[model samples]
Target chain A: MSTGDFIFTGLGHAYLKDNWIFRNYRGEAVRGQVLALLGPNGSGKTTLLKILLGALTPSEGSVNIQGQVAFVPQLFQVAFDYTALDMVLMGRAKKVGLFSQPTPADEEAAINALERMGIGHMAYRPFHEMSGGQRQLVIFARALVAEADILILDEPTSALDLKNQNGILEWIDRLARRENLTVIFSTHHPHHAYAVADQALLMLGENDFESGPVGDVLTEKNLLQLYGLPLKRLTFDYEDLNVETLVPVFRNCKRRKAN
Target chain B: MTEKTVKQEKFSACSSGRFRRWLPKTPLARPWILGLILLIAIIGSLFMGAYPIPWHRILEILLNSVWPFSGSESAYLDLREITVVTLIRPPRILVAVLAGIALGMSGTALQGMMRNPLVGPDLVGVTSGAAFGAVLAMWLGFLYTPVILVLSTIGGIAAMLGTMALARVVGGRNDSLPLILAGFFIGAFFLAGVGLLIYLENPFYPKGQRTGNIIYWLLGTFRGAGPVKAWTIAVPTIVGGTVLMGLRWRLNLLSLGDLDASSLGINLNRLRWILITVVSLMVAGQVAVSGVVGWVGLIIPHAARMLVGPDHRRLIPASAMLGGLFVLGLDNFTRTVIWSEVPVGVLSAIFGTPLICFLFWKTKTKGWNE
Candidate 1:
């Protein structure tokens, strides 16, 4: 299928009867293009993604995603003690018959994904023992192993370090370019959108939002409005540094006032 | 790499490979292994009891009992030995095995559904609910075992629904701790109801009434268990277990959290209802037959996970087999090793605690949830 074949639209979603989580949200998410959704936390970024993923039903609008979509959840809740390979095999759940055990091919596919992510050595590691960032990578690999035409990631690099974050972004960028996989990701970071997104979706509020090419939606005015801050997107000498290096600078927002 | 990272990598390498390699290859293998051991243990179970039957004779009697048409023209193959093997031993062993399998898979399913290792009938109100129902039926002079079974099953399912509904009220993902809390409170509510019923029954009891017997059975037992009860419990547990195995993918998806499951083409609401109903049915049937055997459901899953990886395809069947073996083994111990017939429930508590503690200790090095 072509990249622009499917369009995702959300009519609305309300958390309570009155309080709208998202409303009248209409957007076209194309295949083969990386779409980055940017908004403040709890501002319906994840909710919009969930709607697109068909996880949540929009109260007022409709959502349509074409073809099979693989999702990398923001936080994975694992109760059972599964292995890294076991977790990766879960990505193939849609393909494998319900009663069918993981075939050798499935295992090989999982192994390959882990290896490509530089986590081949930890393929047999207990999932619970891995670091948060490492677990996130495994979850990403899980999404990738599905070989779904559309990959939806929710803050995939939120927990990663500098190197891993860059590695993941590069991997995602390459996947979108080469494999022609449509990618939809949600993040709070403006730079991340600038770096990886072909199209940026700015959820303005419960009632307002905009979607366009990355530069247009990630402009200073839109980001400032979205964050509700007097924000400036300044170029720094540490541009070479990945997003993780900027985490301390970004996370210490209250410290700026103290200074 | 940092020293910590290197250590972690080294630790992970050996640990993951060794554990994965150690896991049982086929789901069938665990049961085969456990079944073989349990067969031997059943022979041991038969050897026990007041009669000091020889192993060879026990085997002969067992074979004759099962294969009555086999042309064994031995005078010693009489009704008493047949009664020992067929009437007494088989029914009792069957009950124990069924109870174990039921509790084991129930725990496995509940743990998977709730995503909590600590949750089971005891913590989740199913046991107490069924106990109250069974006790109420008995105290009300319902002499029929089938009636007690029906009442207890309904009671257990009702309690599970109430607990789940309470979780729904809390308004978050249906998680382990919240469901546990819901079960705890609901269980306590049912306990109070049982207590009130007992208080009411006290006025009608004649001298030497043994009111405590009802309470003791609720603690759990395998006494006076017959084949009828075995079939009643076994059918539902086996059927429910089959369905659970069928929905392994959905269960695994749910393990990723509700939203993740929905996105992956699982109809979350439909599945949630189906799984809860099926699980409740199995648990109710089990509670009806065996009062409320504890730990098997909670501990068996962990044990099964250790043997087979947490892939439900393997974990579910393995849990069922190992559970059956564990319970039968414990019941055999309760029957033969002691002067008094100790119930399997009490023994499981006595035994399962130490094993669980050791499990926790063993997995402390590697993350348990992993």
Candidate 2:
């Protein structure tokens, strides 16, 4: 099934008595595509994602989802220790009966997902003992084992080093293409979105947002307006390799005065 | 090249493969072993009272009771011995087993639901609330068993609801810190109320009478066990335990926190309310009969987890059986070893504290997650 078909009309949310965070937001994500939601802090990106995951009810408007959606949270803090395999097996909750335990087949699927992520060896390791990036990969494997066609990730690469960030983004791109899964992930890095995302959603403010093909919605003018900062798009080509970069000008900020 | 080398190294370093070989192939094996142990403990406990019955007679009586059709009524068996062995001992042992099962299952559910290992009936004020209710019933001269049962059930449910509501109001939905704080406050409030009741009753009753009642409420005992009391604790414990066991897999999901559980297609509000209701019933039933038994709930599940990992499927049944064994063993020790009959609650703490400390130390060294 092409599970990424989602349409939101006039989506809005307001918290704490009439203070609107985002209102009248409209967007659509096609099947088998990756939509990158870009915004700075306090831009309601997380709220929008929650609304899509159906964890939060939109104050106005409706959202239509074509298939099951699995959510990969940014981080998980467990009070008790669970193994990485145990964590991944939790994804089979929807498939198993409420009273029934996970079957051997389910265990096989969890192990397969971990192997797919190149972390099968960590299956029995305690999740809390693993490094942040490794835990993030386990979370990804958990989402994969859910068998959902639509994967929603909340800032999947926010707190990772360079190699780990690239690894996660590369996995997302490859998974979307190989399995025809639809993915929506939020990120602070615009370059990462440019590298992998097929579409972009830019949240400018409480009432203003933009969504379209990545090439159209992620232009220098749109990002500059989104962050209210000067940025430049640079491209270079050499020996059949092309590189694109979005660099901040960093000239507009004034030096801080001594307190 | 480094990534490939690291992958190779990790493949060889997978310790779970070694661990899996030591674990039972089926989940039911450990629980069955524990059940056998409990059965042996029960039979052994029957031989321990002031009127000592021989083991051979105890065995013959048990066998004849189960197989009445078999023509093997021993002519040598004394009527008094039969009465003590069959009639007197079974009810008390059944009560202890049922109470242990209730506390262990409830503790597993609450700890999983709250996602805190330290949480128990006492931590959540359920025991204290029930204690207050039972103590108040005694103070009011309503010494009827049914009256105390009803009042304690209501009190336990009320305290849990109050704690949950306080947690919600103070810190959004089911935040752990606020819930624990609310439990501590509510528990303390009810415990003080119990103390006040004891003080008020001191003048009307003699000092010994008042003190004994208060001690019974604080340190649980099974001396009051009879057929009626056994059924009172057994029926609810069986029903509630079956329900909790049925939802064991879901309980595993609940430990992941609310949002993750919901995202996985669990109805969080519905499941939470069901858990709270069943857990309250189990705790109230046990508390009404045995007074506020502490630490059996807390320590047994932790021990079970050490044996059976954190999967609720194995953990729940293992906990229940181990709890039965632990309480039965302790009660046997209380009746047989000590000249004075010490309350099981007091003995549990005396023994449970050091074991819990050891468990904590072991968990810290081995890593709880491992």
Predicted model with the maximum DockQ:
2
Candidate 1 off by > 4 Å: A1-10, A97-100, A112-121, A131-133, A228-259, B1-31, B66-73, B76-79, B139-142, B171-175, B202-213
RMSD of 2: 4.6
Note the residue pairs that clash in candidate 1: A3-A31, A11-A60, A11-A61, A12-A59, A12-A61, A81-B370, A82-B370, A128-B370
Q: What is each predicted model's overall lDDT from 0 to 1?
A: 0.74, 0.83
Estimate candidate 1's alpha-carbon lDDT, on a 0 to 1 scale.
0.74
lDDT of 2: 0.83
Instruction: Give the per-residue lDDT of model 2 (tens digit) for B136-229.
Output: 8778777666677778878888888888788888996446688889989999999999888876774666667866766775689988588988
Candidate 1 chain A minimal-lDDT segment of 10 residues:
A242-251
DockQ of each: 0.42, 0.45
Mark the 10 consecutive residues where model 2 chain A has the least summed lDDT. Answer: A249-258
Where model 2 places Cα greater than 4 Å from the true spot, the runs are: A252-259, B1-29, B63-73, B136-147, B172-176, B199-218, B366-370
RMSD to the true structure for each prediction, in A, is 5.0, 4.6
